[model samples]
Target: MVENALGDANSVFSSKRAALRVLVNHGEKDGLTAARMILTGIPLDETYLQNRLSIPMNDEKKSLKGGRIHIPDSYYLMGTADPTGILKSDEVCIILSFWYMHQ
Candidate 1:
């Protein structure tokens, strides 16, 4: 019984770990999370590598007084405090997008 329990636990752990790995590598976004980021002053930089914006807190240590999104494709950076910074506007509002296509 003990051995069987251990095996089951291991199996569950492995699956969870695998899922995490995929999420980390590919990047996953939720609308709510993205909205929070925007509200917190973190702009969305979608034009990242592999259409995936994995912003691992560029300025993690710093409490975000304000943040900007650097969209490499348009070469325009958007700041929440300063909406005028955006050269092009996206249809989605404050989208925390995981997948960004690179042309």
Candidate 2:
């Protein structure tokens, strides 16, 4: 009985360690993807932003600040010269700002 209990505990610990490793690997991959997107001046999709970055979009629970002329329902960033851009600036700066601030 003691041997069986020890084996079960070892199995559970190994399983949890493997799961943590997978999560860490995924996080590294996602970080690389975000960096590439920023460097290439590509706009991030809503799914990636919300799901991976954990930025809420179009949430009714959040209240908007008063006296704002233009209120965006979702966050956005685009390169300069794009008139329709929400956050108009270089992609690297915008993405880095979000990444650091979110942490």
Candidate 3:
């Protein structure tokens, strides 16, 4: 569904290929947060870190504000393990958080 959505030229998400790939590779929640961060061009900060790359649960169940793409829970699980052994979940999160902070 996500791959198909990305192919639509008229879709708001059409240009967000990289972020979508991250979404597919990772999971919807983190992927969406990363995509928003990319779109907003906002540097990671204490506030964002405190929030932990997640849309608030109440807000998440409904549609995302501003008509952003929302991946339903049925499409993916709450958590995903990395297929490759290159990094553990904590390590990956730490690296991403660090990279985002430094940027």
Write out the backbone clash pairs for model 1: 51-100
Worst 10 residues of 2 by lDDT: 55-64
For candidate 1, write residues 2-103 as lDDT tens digits. Answer: 343223223322343322332333233642343344446543343332122223222211212244322223433354643566544553335444455431
Rank list by lDDT: 3, 2, 1
Estimate the lDDT of model 1.
Answer: 0.33
Task: Report lDDT per candidate.
Answer: 0.33, 0.36, 0.42
Per-residue alpha-carbon lDDT of candidate 3 for residues 1-103, written as tens digits (9 for 90 to 100) = 4344333322222244433443443445665666566567654443652243333322332333335454543232244576777875566422234464443
TM-score of 2: 0.21
Q: Please give the distance, in angstroms, between residue 3's alpha carbon in candidate 1 and its true position after superposition.
A: 27
- Expressed as tens digits, the lDDT of each residue in 3-38 for candidate 2 is 433232233223433222223333466645544543
lDDT of residue 5 for candidate 1: 29
Candidate 1: where are CA atoms >4 Å away? 1-14, 30-103
Model with the higher lDDT, candidate 1 or 2: 2
TM-score of each: 0.17, 0.21, 0.23
Candidate 3: the clashing residue pairs are none
Error of 3 at 90 (Å): 41
